[model samples]
Target: MLTILVTGATGNVGQEVIRLLLNQNCQVRAAVRNPDTATEILSVHPTAGFSDHSIDRVPFNFTNPATFATAFQGVDKLFLVRPPNLANVRKQIAPALEAAKRAGVKQVVFLSILGADRNPILPHSKIESYINRLGIPATFLRASFFMQNLNTTHKEEIKTRGELVLPAGHGRTSFIDVRDIAAVAVRTLMEDGHSHKAYTLTGGEALTYYEVADIFTAVLGKPIHYTNLSVWNFIKQMRDRGLPMDFITVMVGIYTTARLGLASHVTPDVEQLLARPPLTVRQYVEDYRQFWL
Candidate 1:
């Protein structure tokens, strides 16, 4: 069995990856900060039905170098997620990639953003460069905006105010589901012939926030509006929500990308890799309707 070490194991994508890997009967090592807590979370995961003994949870933290070797041990491949809070790629992520190299991790699937390769200003680009510099065999999954962000980040606003707030004015984004991203990641990790390549993953359709709000309305039977704020106002709103400056900065960059009409490209990589069409926003809203209700 191939042993795959999954960082960010408790995250949305990580949990789904674990679920799929377990179904494939692959040995999964989940690197988490708290094994016991991870055990609790994974135990109740609806799709991840593995018993506690099936997974090996190793304590790992990007900010703490001491935990890297133990997590990488005996792992043939790696699925890497860059925590949104860790903005400094050089300081927070480089050492762990170096340690993975030392531990002989043969392949890596890195979760990156859609424009990271072209936008050197983003931290994901810097991390990609470092992975190349380390000479680690890797596949970059440059995923587009996740549909789950509606429930995770903007849920409060939508549920409370019945509106989507962002600085993406009249810009369409080809939003994808995290589940699809996870599926693609698992395939790259398990199969051969997917090394040193970058795939831009996105949903099949590009839709503006106005269209997204219509989908929500159709699903939930409630009025949801897209409040297009100015960039400064959006920053103020995020600051008022008590988000850290680093996270706010990343969001600003992402929205700015959208506003410039750069994130609107739809791609067929997800369907090609998974042999199924990517999930649509209407489907996402219908499935997650309770979040807005």
Candidate 2:
């Protein structure tokens, strides 16, 4: 059986990837910072048909090079996820890819953001260049903005005030679901014909914040308003909520990308990969309605 190493196994997309891979006939090694707490971290995900013992937990950290070799050992393919905080690709991610190369990892499927290739300063683009430099056979899954951001980043605001607050003025985002991204990752990792290619993953349709608010209202059976704040006010709001400057800056950058209309491009890659249309915004809102209430 082929063995695969999954980085960021505790995250939303990682957990979904592992869950789907567990249903297949492959060996999965979850590379985590703390192997001891892997179970606790993964318990939040829905585990319908698999047990925790099925996944081998190995210690891995981007900042620490010592854990890289051990985690990459005997792995045929690797799913790489750059941690949100680690923007310095040279210092943090290079060592791990080097270790994976040294360990003879055959394939790599990296989770990257949309437009990473054009944006030179983005860490994902740098990492992509590094992988090519190292001569590793790889695939890049450049996914659009995740729909789950509503449930996670803006959930508090929606739940408490029934408002979607952001600086994305009149911008429509092709918001894809994390589950669809995971499915594509699994395909690239486990299947053939996907090497050395970059796929821009997006939902079936693009929706503006106003349309998103309408969907939320229809699903949750309550009026949800989209509070479009100015860029400066958005920063102030994040600061008032005691968020870190780095995180606030990242959020601002993402919203600015949307405001510029760069994030509105729809793609056919998701349907092409999954053999079906990607999940719609209304579907996501309906499935995750309890979170807003």
Question: Which residue runs of candidate 1 sit more than 4 Å off their true CA positions?
Answer: 46-50
| Tens digits of lDDT, candidate 1, 60-85 | 99999989878888889999999999
Q: 1-293, model 2: which lDDT tens digit per residue?
A: 99999999998789989999998889999999998788777766743434868999999999999888789889999999998888888998898899999999999999999999999888889999999999999999999999988998999999999999999999889999998999999998888999999999999888889999999988898999999999999999999999888888888988888888989999999999899999999988888887889
Clashes of 1: 0
Clashes of each: 0, 0
Residue 143 CA displacement from its true place in model 2, Å:
0.5
Ten-residue stretch with the least lDDT total in model 1: 42-51
- In TM-score terms, candidate 1 sits at 0.97
